[model samples]
Target: MEASSEQPQSVSVHLARLVIFSAVVLGLIVGTLEVTLEYKKLRTTLFEHSEQVAKAFEDIAARAAANRDRSLAEEVATGLLEFKSIASVEVSDETGTVLAWKECGQVEAFGSWLPFEIPSAQHTILLELSTPSSGGEAKGYLKVTASSAQATQIWASQLGMVLISVLFGTALLAGTLLFITHLYVSRPMLRLAEAFRRLDVSDPKNSPLPDPEMFRFREFREIAENGVRLMRDIKRNSEVRDLTANELYRSQKRLQDFAEISSDWFWESDRDGGITYISPSFTKTLNKKTGEVYGRTIAQTTAEPVNTPKWHKLGEIQRQRRQFRDFRYDMAIQPGEVKTVSINGRPFYDEDGTFIGYRGTGADVTNERLIAEARNEALQRAEQASRAKSEFLATMSHEFRTPLNAIIGFSSLLSMPELLKAGVDRVTEYSTAINDSGQHMLALVNDILDISAIEAGKRVLTLEEVEIDGLLSHSLSQIESQAGAKSISLIVEQNAQVGTMVSDERSVRQILLNLLSNAVKFTPSGGEIRVTVDEIGKDIVFRVADNGIGIPSDRLPTIAEPFSHSAIHPHVAKEGTGLGLSIVRSLAVLLDGGFTIESEVGTGTTVTVRLPKNGSGASGEVQTA
Candidate 1:
């Protein structure tokens, strides 16, 4: 069904109608109120007049009642009825016997002529027939009733005058407003509308608006001037729009060509999210036919559940009909094969602004995903390395300072005049202390140099046949004093049949020293340390187990890393340089040996080093047990 197109009313007619309606309604309200107030005043005046008449007839009625003369009472009542407002008069004695009764027929006749009856007002007065010396006694009553019909008739006449005046004023006001509006607003607006109607927007440059000076009022003149400026702007915009349209067409063509050749595919879906149209690039990228995807929903084709957070967010965007960019998800191209897909899309709507579906471009971003992952991994490693370096420097500073401070303090003590003069025994003690500090500092520097050389692939290994028992004894002897200091028991389990192995003697000795030193450092008083050696397959395994404060499982992975001691045991005193385990791992690797650590918090730690009997120059991998 077609809608009817009604011709719109002009501004002048609409304004005139509005003015007439408003003025009439306001006038009616005011007129009605005035008439009501005037009626009330008239009613009050009539009532007052009735009361005055009754009072005047009271003395005459009293005298008549005292004398028991009906004629005199009748005369009083008849005189009271003479007033036009008085409808009826009645006289009664103290005994309730009526002396006179009279009523004017004119009031009844007037009320009958009216469509509605008016209620009358009545007044009564007591007649006193007593001397001045005595209190007054009512001898009779005089009553006068005033008909409200007269006041009502007067109100009606006044109401008619008010209504007539209101109509005249309302009409006059409406006509005046209409004339003024037509001359100033309506006529100018009509001219402007006519000018627009005749305007050819295609040739707006030539179809200029009428001059603003033609209007009489300033507001109309300004409006006309604004219209002229608006037309000028329209003309300018029209020319620009034409150029933009041409450029936009070319840009769209270029975009279409790019979309066809690009590896990324374009797709469109219906409101139900079912695939409707997909570009050829989709098949080329995903190795799938477009027909296979057509009936499938986005969730099905994308290989993700709608309940997943990414799809849930995408659903929310679609529900809101909002645009989305770089929406990434995984799609399965084949069994056991998945590709990360990134898409950019916007909700498409019909000309009437009803959402039809979504249209977007997508690409298989598998390679980009892998690259991003690699980049992130590298970044994390860099951060870890940076942190390790910072910790290493801090540990080195403390480690170096401790011995340096000891050497300085002891040397100062040895040089003291009073101490030297005391005895040679005191001087020898200070000298010995200084020598110990120097030895400790030397060991710290050697360890750092060893680690750096091994890392730089510059460490040369001296491979030789070394007795297992002698090597174990030497390593044990180096840490015996440290173990005795803590009262920790040291135990060794050696296989008598395992005689000797060809390996780097210095690297092996350093590894055993570091492992044993760490045990003594961490072990509590009365704790036990065990060293075990066994030949397995082509490799010889050395295990150092300690019943000491152990590493937390989470730190096990990076515990062998340089300077990780501070991170692992943050609450422990900063004693060692935190490079013992790292050095052990590196040396083991350089000798083609595998190093492993197994630990549990509050339990204990076990470190295993397995070296090939015949040393290999190639580096080995570290393993966590």
Candidate 2:
């Protein structure tokens, strides 16, 4: 396309030619004018010089002619001829008789400035010589002829210089214009044309239009920018048109496929409710003959001794000349398996509005109906999951912020002058509160990190043989202060026979501490919290029971899920982060263990952890009940 728009002359050539031609014409005009003016001035100078010479020798020539001294008169003429510009000199007596005459070499017919020979008469000047100094009478006439060679040579030299300068300047100007046009205009235009030609039509997105910034000329830049915009618009339009055409084609193809398939079929009936035409695909679906069903009512062809309200309703519509759509019915095709079909129909009318017949389509929609139901169920589940996550984030925010607020508030109070003067006990109390808040925050952070690590498969258990008795002792000791602060009783019981189990000590300790702390927090003052360790078969069992607020039986199923606090115990307001139970469950899995929780609303709650006696089996085997 760009190639076809090429002009015979490029812009640079056109500009250069125009400017050079103008310069030549101007040079010629100026040179001609200068030569003409100089020639006139030369003629006037020659004539004036000739007249002065003739007058100077007037007295001498008159004296010589009066005495008839021909030698003396000839002497003066010869002296005048000494100047090369004087081509001829003639001196005659007062009677007009020629006395002395001299003539030198003839001037050339053609000189530098003049294209043809100049007339010798034009350069010749004749002056009268008044003989006596005081007398006006002429004794002789002096005719002097000055050759124009000197003047012509001078004019030719000047004109040659002027023409040389003009030619040089014109060439320079043309060269400079060509250079600038090629650099800033022509080159960029060619590059842009090439870019447009090479643009990939298959992937318009990847093919970018030429950048206007790449050009030096303002007009070219503007043109490039507008061209790019136009190309982009064309690309977008092309994409949209292609997409629409593709969609249209797909729709048509789908319709054609549907028309050819036996899954969905078309049928027509008369106003009398008798089957007039049944599509071949419809007969194939029923595994029956089209001839068998022709002219028969729908109830007569495939009717069975079963509930078919759709048929009855369709018959009523036919009698009333009304339209019915997507009326579902069950057809017990031969051998007792029912195939549910949904049909749609509209009553047709003639020109005069008389009822003609009914025409519609039907499909075996049993599988489609089942699929739609499954999708609805999946959507409902997704919505529920989304709601659960939202609630979890809200609850977790409160859980995290509570400790942060406490830590900040108490730390600020600890800096008070009054508290400093109040003495050590108050300082210690504030310090303890800060410490507890800090620990709570740390636990929350750890739980989140741990769960994330487990989910990402980065959580590895460093297993070792850990004594059950020592673990129990350490867990109980850590939470004893917490229990004491609440005035809750702590009980520890363990079986000596249940010795040691290979497991991650840190994880087990975390599990124990979390459960014991929960017990301490929830158990009212004076209530008992027991930590019992025993052996059950190949697993070592640890149970932490507290006579605190317990969970209802209905909430047990989802209790182990992260942030399932609200779902677990909707009415009870729990203080601890909901992550504790979830973390414990995850850790139990990581260390090859089983975890369970049994609770009654007002009675108490007991959480049990069972780990494999030896960590020989694969870790991350968690069973919860």
Candidate 3:
């Protein structure tokens, strides 16, 4: 069987052992001192007794010595030996002759039987014999040797009794002290310890301590009171600590939720600006894992070069430990795909004010960037439209007033009696001038209405099979007189293989007429115009060429837009409503065809129109000029 481990001694047991040991040590010291003092007293008493015996026998011994009386000396020595302290005695004469000797054999034997040895005491006495008249004369010497055997034996008996008494007293005192300490100190302290052991710090109010009054000693009572106060303080501090921890946990959870749910990603970096943490939203925003981004600096993630102004500014801000916001940059998240990112960050420091690094939120702002660009573009378009409207109003005013002025002047002339009676030819000329101005005004109004209808999506097409040659010939014939007025040459090239095509007859004819008219208007006198019609693939292609003051290259992009002429040459813009090409373009689009124009300053222009053979149902491709 395994031996039980040694149990620890309680305070009471330890105190009892200490008291017993102290009492035993003190008893031993007192006993030894008493025994030693008794021994010395016994020796002194024996010496004193020997001196008395010597004095009493002095006269007798001297007389014996002078007379040489052996019986007398023997009597003195034997008498001295009668005393228990005197173990042996000898009487000697002046001549050195021993007169008598006596010794106690029993005393010697007794000393030898004793547990310890005691040395015999020795004394010498002088003997004198003399008359009263004559001074006493020395007669003999008396030698006395005393044995301490009896005294030592007596001392031993007393010592044994004294030690017994001391032992009994020491044991009794130790027992009494042990009881007192256990009751007054040890037991009370043990109770206090047990109370502490059972105490619940978590609920200090309900966990009572041993009452201070339970301890008999003032010091112990005070200790109990202090323990109560300490536990109370501990409970209060613990409650506060728990509350703070709970609040901190909730705050952290809220921040975590915000980071998880937000569209933006949160990031943290070390002091060297290397990425330490990136939230899960980083993957959602950049289409890359957070792990891949870790250990990389912000500059490494950007498409821009590290030495770019944006990075330089960011570096400067970080170096100065400042906050920055709305810092936008481009990041190539994937091959050939760059996203715009905006970040707001601030430098963080530890409690000791050592720079930690940066923490911030970043959002993929590519969509926002695109939207902003589109908004700016729309604003520019609106401004251009407003300017064009003003120009159109100005051009229209001039065009209208010119015709109105002619009509008013001619009508006023007709109203005058001198003009009315002038002649039929004059009247006819005035009337024709008014008619021509009205017709010009009517044509301008028609162009305006047609353009408005097209823009409003109200224009419709009536598709049919059409003769390409007939259409071209009719279109060229309408502009022939205008070309003749300028003495310009009009050339037509028609492919016989381009016999017919299915399309909106009116739109096709109108498209060709507008092209021819624009050519005539732009061509100088004696310049040439060429018209070509051919079938290309599944479409009928029409080309109108002019050797005239061609359109400016810068204005070509918007040349087919209505009222765009003001941006071109002012002289050419004023001569017409600037809706001819616009109408042609709109009609071509409505019929699912394409129109393109190529022009150069002083080098002339070429305008091409592609009409699908199958009309609005067929796809027509537009070639860029």
CA lDDT scores, all candidates in order: 0.81, 0.76, 0.82
TM-score winner:
3
Q: Candidate 2 residues 1-625, lDDT tens each?
A: 3567655776667776887788778777877787779877876787677667766777777777666678988997898887766778887877887778999876554444545655433467777766556378776677877776666655667667777787887778767877887787778878778778767777777787888888777887888888888778878988898999999999978866776675678788887768887676776676666677679766665545424675567677778877787877666666666666788888888999988888888877768777988999788657755766776777778878898898889899998888889899988998999898899788777877887787676776777878778888888888788788888988778887888887777788889988987777668888998888898888888899999878778777767776665533455656655667888887777776788999987889999988888776635532221
Arranged by lDDT, best first:
3, 1, 2
Model with the higher lDDT, candidate 2 or 3: 3
Q: In candidate 1, what are the lDDT values of residues 1-625, reduced to their tens digit?
A: 9777998777788888899999999999999898888888888888887777777666677788777789998898788877877777777777878888898885434334446755654544444443233358777666666777778777777777888899999999999998898877777888877766776888887785778888777887887788788888988999899889999999988877887799999999998888898888888888877898896777787666668787888888888889999988888788888888898888888999888988998888999999999999889778877888887787778878988999999888877788968898888888898998899899888878877888887887777787888999999999999899889999999877778988878888999999999888877889999999999988889999999888877778887887665543565444766789999999888887899999877678899999888665435332211
Better lDDT candidate (1, 2): 1
**Against the hidden reference, what TM-scores do the models get?**
0.53, 0.40, 0.62
Any runs in candidate 1 off by more than 4 Å, and if so which?
1-256, 282-308, 331-339, 349-356, 366-375, 493-497, 617-625
Clashing pairs in 3: none
Q: Is candidate 1 or candidate 3 better by lDDT?
A: 3
Model 1 residue 575 lDDT? 75
**Candidate 1: clashing pairs of residues:** none
> For candidate 3, what is the lDDT?
0.82
Query: Which runs of model 2 end up more than 4 angstroms from their true locations?
Result: 1-393, 413-429, 484-496, 523-534, 545-547, 567-571, 619-625
Number of the top lDDT candidate: 3
Q: Give the TM-score of candidate 2.
A: 0.40
Candidate 3 has a TM-score of 0.62
- For every model shown, the clashing-pair count is 0, 1, 0
